[model samples]
Target: MKLTSVSKSLRKLRIPAVLFRRLAVAALPLLLLLALATGCSLFERGGSSAISHKIDQEEDVISSNGGVISNLDKLDSFMERGSGSQRIVQYTIEGDPIFIETRYEGGRLELSYDTTEDAFGPREVKTYSCDKLVRTEEKHQLKYSLKGCGEDMGDGDLLTVDFDLGRQDKFEFILKYGFNHRNEINTVNQNLVKDMLDGTVIEISDYGLPVEDRQSIYRKLVLSNYLGEKQLSTSCNLKPYQSYDLTVLINSAERHYAWSECDTGRDGKVMTEAAEYIIGLVEAGDSFLQLPAATGSVK
Candidate 1:
C-alpha cells in the first residue's frame, strides 16, 4: 500500500516538471535578447539627423567591454553611412602604435583609445567628436554662447576646438580644420543698426573689416610662411587631450571645407606664423588603429 501511494505521487509531479522545463527552454532566448537591448541604450544627441545612440553602461574588459557611442542600438545605421570597409590611421606613441577605435557619421569623425590595451597599462577610455563651428564678437566680451555638438563625448570628457580657426584675405583658408573657432558677425548685423532697430552700433573697423579683417590677417599670417602651410596641411597640430576638434572656414574663400590627419608627434602643437595670425597644436602620435581599407562606398 505504501509503494502504491508513492508511485501515484511521483506520476503527478512528472507533468509539472516537464512543463517547467519546457517553459525555461522557451524563455532563454527572450532573456538574452532583452539583455542586448538594454545594453545598447546609452548614446544620445540633440539632433535627429545625427546618428544618436548609446550603450547605457560601461561594463566588461577593455577589449570586451561596452561604452556609449553616437549609435549603439542601430550600429547598422552607422555602418550604412559608411562603407563596410574602414580606414585605420595608425601612428606610434613612444614606439608602438596605440590601438584605437574609430567611427564616422553626420560628417564627423571620432576615435577612442584605451590604455588597458596600450603599452602604458590600463588608463581611462576615451571617445572623441567634432566641435561645432563658432564665431565671437571681438572686444565686445561676447558672452560665449555656442551650440552644443548635438551629442555628448560620454562622461569624464570635455569639448574643445580640434583645429585652429583662421581668417584668409578675410576670405582664403588653406588646408582644412585650420579655421576653427572663427568669429562672424550676427547674420542680422544689418538689422541691428543703432538708429534703425535699437541702441547698438557695431563699430565698423577702418577698412570696414570686422570679423573679415580678423580672418584676413589670419590667412595672411599663415599664407606666406612655410611652417604655416605645413601646419595647415598636417593635422599634427591637434592636441590629444582636446575633444571636439573641427575646422570651420572663417571667410568665404575658405568655404571648400576640408580637414585631414597626420601620423607624428604626441601633443598637437604646431608652429605657424598665422597666429601672428594663429596656428598652434601638438601632434600626439598616440593616434592609430587597425581595420580594412575604405572603398569609398557610403556603407
Candidate 2:
C-alpha cells in the first residue's frame, strides 16, 4: 500500500512537468515569430516616407508660389543643397517690340506691319500696311494670337495679320519681343521654345513654369513644324522689335490650333504642319541642341 501511494504521487508530479513542457514548446515559436514580425514592421516604415513627403511638400510650396521669385541668389543656394537634377530658369521682360516683315500672297505681295508688345501695358491701336499691290478694301485689323495663348496672358498679346496687297498676302506668326519689347508671363513660353530650338543660352526663368512645361517647350520647339524653314532672325531693317517679352510665330502665321483636336479632328493640322516644318529645320540645323546643365551644385 505504501509503494502504491508513492507511485500515485509521482504520477501527479510527472503530469505537471509534461504540461509545462508542452506550454513552453508551443509558446516559444509564437514569441519568436511575433518578435520577427515586429522588427519587419519597423523596417518597412522607417524614415523613407517622411523624407519623401518632406521633399514633395517643399516642391509643392515652391511651385504654387513660383510667380514672385524676388531673390535669385537664395534660389541658387537652395539648389546647391539638393541632389539629382535641378533647373533654374530666368528671363526678364524688357519692353521690346517684335516686327515681322514678309512676302505673302504666294510670295507675290510684300507686306510690312508693326505689332506692339508690352505685357504689363495695353493697346487700342495696331498698325498694318501693304507696301505692295493693292486693289480692294484694305483690312487693317491687327491680328492677336489665335492660339490658346490668351489663358494667362491677355488678348492682343501676340499679333497676326492677313493682308492682300493684290493677291491676298498674309504676314503671319511674327515675333518682336525682346529687351526693348515686353511680353506677358504666358507667351514667353514660346520664346523659351525658340531659344532652345536655336541653341541659344536662355537662362530659363523657373519663375512661373514647372520643369515639365519647360521640357515640354523644349521638345515642342526642338521638333516643331511651325518653326521649320523659319529662321530666328533679328528684325534688321524696317523697325526693331520693341516693348515685348519674346517673339514667336516670327516666320509664318499660326492657324487656329488645338492638340487634342488634331489627333482626332481638324484644327491641329496647322499646328502639325508648323511642327513638321520646325522638325525639318531641326534635322538640317547647326542650330539648337539641349544643354543639359553641368552635373554639380546649382551655384
Candidate 3:
C-alpha cells in the first residue's frame, strides 16, 4: 500500500491527541531512514503504478517461496540499500517509453525516449546539469521541475554519417562524417585504395570541410527526406560485386533517429545519392584527388 493511504487510515482511527503526537514523533526518524535507505527522495517523479506493480511481483514470488527470498530483488528497498549517487526513473508518456536518469556524482541528468518509428533504435539522449531537482504532486501526478539547470545538447542539432563502399575489385573505403551546430564539418576517411605502383595501400586521412560545402550537403540531405527513410532488409543471396552501406544519425530532443542500410542486395536510391554527393564534395579537394579513386573498378 502507498504511504499516503496508510496516513489516511491512521487519521480515521481518531487516536487521542497526545498519543498521536507521540506516534508521529516516533515515526519521523524511521521515515527519514527509509528514504535514505532507498536512495530516492519521497518526492521523486515517477509513476507510482509501475513501482507498485514491481513490488507486487516481488511479493508474489516471496509468497510462492514461503516468505524465503532465494532471488534477491536488486531494486531499491528499505532492506536492500541502493547507491545514492545515481537514480533512474522509467515511465511512459502517451505510449512512448521515457527514461530519466540522474547522476549525483557529476550533477548530470539525462532524458531519453524510445521513438515510435523504431522501438529498438538508438534513443535520443539530452543532458543537463544542475545542483538539485525539485518535484511537485499535481492532481495525483508527480511533475519534475528542472530549475537552474543548463542544457548541454538539443534535438536535431547534431548530425553524423557513416558511409562504406566496396568495389568489385576487392577495394573498400569507409567515411565517418560529423556536423555540429557550430557549422563545423569533419570527415575521417579509411580506405584501401589500389595505387598503380603500390598495388594497394591503406590511406587514412582526417580533415575539415568548408562550411559552405557543409551547408550544401545538409540542405541536400534534408530535401531528400533522409531522416524519414527507414532501413531496408538485406537479401539472402551471395554478396554483390559492388555494394554500399550507409548509416545516418540525427540527434533530437526526444530521441536519436538512425537510418542505416548495411550490405543490402541493392543500395537505397536516396541514401546512395546522399553518400555520393558527400564523396564528390570531398574528392573535389586537391589533396583528396591525390589518393586513388575510392570508387570504380581497378583498371
Candidate 4:
C-alpha cells in the first residue's frame, strides 16, 4: 500500500495522541494510577473514553436513586444532633391573644399552649404554621404542615380546645386504695399514701357504669383522643407502701394503678372524679380485696 494509505489506516486503528492525553488529564489521579499499575484495558481502546463511560454510568445510578453529590455534608449531619424551632399565633374568639412556644428537645419536639381564661371571656384560638422537616428519598426538606383544628398536634400535645367537659358524659372506671405496711419510706407510694390512716383497706366492689359512660371516660384519657384544653404534669401518684397492692381497673378489665397514672402525669380532672366516685361506691358496698402479689414493686 502507498505511504498515504498506510498513514490513514494507522490513524483509524489507534486513538489520536491529543485525545489520549486529554483522557489521562481527565481521569482521577487514583484511577489513573490504578490503570497504569495494573496495565488494564482502561487505555487499550480509547481508555479515557472508557473511563468517561464508566463515570456516566455511576452518575446515572446515583441520580436514579435520588442521590446528589452536593448534599454529602447534609446527609452526615442528620445522624448528628439536629434542632429547630416553631411559633404559633392564636387569637381568641373575642380577639384576645394566646401563643404557643415550640422547641426541639430530647428526641422529640415539645409544644406548650396557655389554657387559662379571663373573667367574662370567650376564649381565643391560635393556629400554628411551620416548615415540617421530612426526609424525601435521599434529601431532607420542609413540608408545609396542615394548619387548623385537630391537625399537626402530636400525641401528648394539649390544645386549649381539649379542656372543656361541657355536657360530656363522665368517664367510668374503678379505683382501689390499700395501706402499705412496709417500712420503706422513700418510695413514691409511701409518700402518696402517707396521710392515709394505717390499716385502712380500699377495694373495688360490684360497680356498674353504662357502656356509653365508660366509653366517654376512656375518651377523656390522654391515651384517648381528647387532651383537654391543657395538660399539667405533676407527681400525683398514690402508691401503697412496699408489698402493698392497689389495683385500678378501667373498662372493667384493663388493670392499672392509681399512683402509676399520677406519677406518669397522665391523670386529669376526669380521672380524679372517677376515683372519687369509685371511693363512694366502695364506702357503700363490699367487694373482694386484691391482696398484694409477690411482686413487691409499686406500679
Candidate 5:
C-alpha cells in the first residue's frame, strides 16, 4: 500500500526533462542579448557625459582667459554702465601683434585685451574703482585714460606706411582739376582733366620702367626727404575740388596718396614737382615707355 501511493505522487509531480532543457536553451540567447544591450546603453551614456564635461571645461577656460564670460549670460549685462570712454592700444610681443582696449564708465575703469574682432579681445574684465589708478600690468596701466588712449610716440609721427597692393604690379592714378583752376592749368593738365570724366586715367606698370628708372621712382616717392618733413603733415584741403589719387604697389605693399587743390607742403614745391612729372607722362602716351625716366627733385 505504501509503494502504490509513492508511485502515484511521483508521476503527478514529474515534468518532461527534455522539454524543460529545450525551453532553457531557447531563452539563453534572448537573456544574453538583453544583458549586452543594457551594458551598451550604460557605456554610451558614460561616454556622452565625459565629452560634455570636457567641452564645458574648455569653454570655461576660454571664457576666463579673455573670452565672453559665461556667467554674464546677457549681452546688456556686459555693457559698461554710465557715461564711459573707450580706447584701443596696440603693442607687440614676441613679434606677434596684440591689442588692448580700455574703457571707463561712470568712475570705474574696465580694461580688456583682444576680445573680439569688431569688438574686443581676450583679457579679464579689470575694474579700477578710482578715477585714475595704476594696474598690476605696470607698463600698460601708466597709459590708461579717462577719455581715450593712444600710442604716445612723441611728435605724432607714424613709424611705417604699411601697404597692401594685392597681386598686380602696377600703379594707377587719377588727376582732376578744379573748375576754378581749369583755365590756369596747361595742356597736359587739361587732357588729364578731360580724361578724368572719361575714366581714362594713366596706368603705369613696373614692367614699363627699367631697373634704374624703377629705382629712381621708388626712391623719389618712398625715401623722398619730403616724407619726413613735419610741414607736410598739414590738414587735408578739400576746397577747390581739384585732387589726385595715386595708387602703387611697392615691395608687395600697396601704397596710396591723395590730395586736393590747396593741400600742399609748407614749401609749396613738393606737390608742384610731382604733378609736373606725372603730367608729362600722361602726355607721353605710348611713348612714355621709351622716354627717359623723370629726373628732378620731388618738390
Candidate 6:
C-alpha cells in the first residue's frame, strides 16, 4: 500500500498523532524489507535521493553559520568534515555566553572556554590525545574529567600588562615573564635609566636574571604579602586621568592576581616595591628609572 493510504487508515483508527508518527518512522525498515520481498517499491526512483539532498541542504546551512554543532550526536559528523586537519569547533552550552571551544591540531585536541566577561581571568585548558578523544566520542561519553588535564595559567605569567596614563604619554612596554626564568623587556618611545644622576636612556632587551636575583624578587613579593593570597585587600579609586593595570601569575600554585588602580594605596605600594625590585634586577644597579615617566600631574 502507498505510504499516504497507510497514514490515512492510521488516522482513521484515531491513533495519537505523535505515536502514529513515531510508529511510522519505526516501521520504515520493516516496510522496506516487505517491499523487497514482494518485488515492490515503497518510494519512487529518486525519493531517497531527495531525502539525502534535503539533509545536505540542512548541513550546508549549519556549515555556513559558524559550523556550530549544538547536537552532541552530530559531533562526529562535524569533525569528519574537517578532513582530519586543523579545525576549531565552537559551541555554547544551553545558550551560555561562554563558548566551549575545541581545537584540533597536530593530532591533538585542546579544549578551552572562550569568554570576555573576565578578560584577565585565569585560563583553564584541557588537552587530550586524538586517539583517546575518538574513542570517547564513539562510546557516546564525551564528558572528560578536567583534573590532571593540565595546569591552568594566569595571563600574568606572560606579563600581559596594560597601563593607561591618560593625557600623559602614549607608549608601550613589551615584557615577557618567561617560565624558564629568562625574562625580557622591550620599550617603545621609552628608556630605562640607572638613576637621575645618569640621565641616559638605557636600551636593554632579553634580560635574563640570575637565580639569586629571581629569588630575591620572589622573596620581596612574598614578604609584602602580595603572593601570599589569591586576592589582596586594597581600596581602588577611579581617577579617569591615569590608571595602572598589572596581572601576575604565580607559577608555584598556578594562581593569578590582578591589580588595577588609578591611585596608590596598600596594593599600590606593594606593587611599586615589586616593580622597583624587578627594575633594579634589570638594570643590575642600585636604582632604576624610566624616562618620560608614565605618571602625570594630578588635577
Q: Where does candidate 5 stray beyond 4 Å?
A: 1-212, 226-241, 288-299
**Candidate 3 error regions (>4 Å):** 1-199, 236-240, 249-267, 292-299
- Candidate 3, run of 10 with poorest lDDT: 63-72
Clashes (N, CA, C under 3 Å) per candidate:
37, 47, 4, 12, 14, 0
What's the true lDDT of residue 267 in model 6?
A: 49
Tell me the lDDT of candidate 5.
0.35
Could you give candidate 5's per-residue lDDT for residues 1-299 as a string of tens digits? Answer: 12243334545766477764565567556655765765433122321211111223211211222111221111122233434433332323222223333345566544444422222333223223333322112211112123222333112211122122232265333333333323111222222222232323343333232333333343344323223222333234553255544444433444445455555653234554555555554444553444444343222
The Cα local distance difference test for each model comes to 0.31, 0.31, 0.39, 0.34, 0.35, 0.39
Model 6 per-residue lDDT tens digits across residues 10-51 = 789899989999988998888888888886677654312111
Candidate 5, poorest ten consecutive residues by summed lDDT: 66-75
Q: Rank order by TM-score, top first?
A: 3, 5, 6, 4, 1, 2
Write the residue-wise lDDT of candidate 2 on 95-155 in tens digits: 3332323233332322233222434434122223232222222243223222222244222
Indicate whether candidate 1 or candidate 6 has the larger TM-score: 6
Tens-place lDDT digits, model 1, residues 114-179: 433345544345556543223333432212122344456433222111112331223333221222
Task: Give residue 143's lDDT in candidate 5 (0 to 100).
Answer: 21
* Per-model RMSD to reference: 21.4, 27.8, 19.6, 21.3, 23.5, 19.2
What is the Cα-based lDDT of residue 167 in candidate 6? 20
Residue 223 alpha-carbon offset, candidate 4, angstroms: 4.1
Candidate 4 lDDT over 1-299, as tens digits, reads 12343345546768688875565456446565675677653333521211111222111211111111111223224324456543333445554334444445664544444333322343333333332333222111212232222356533322222222233433333233433332211111312112124434232223344344344443334222122122433343455432222232322233343332343333344444444443443333222123332333344
Candidate with more favorable, higher lDDT: 2 or 3? 3
lDDT of 3 by residue, 1-299 (tens): 23564466667899888887787768767876887787655454442221222222222212111111211122223112222332232323233333334444444433332222224535444455554444443322223444455545332211112111111122212333222111111342433222232233334345556656655665555434444424454332443222344444333211122223343322255555666687687667665666655333333
Cα lDDT over the full model 2: 0.31
The Cα error of candidate 3 at residue 82, in Å, is 67
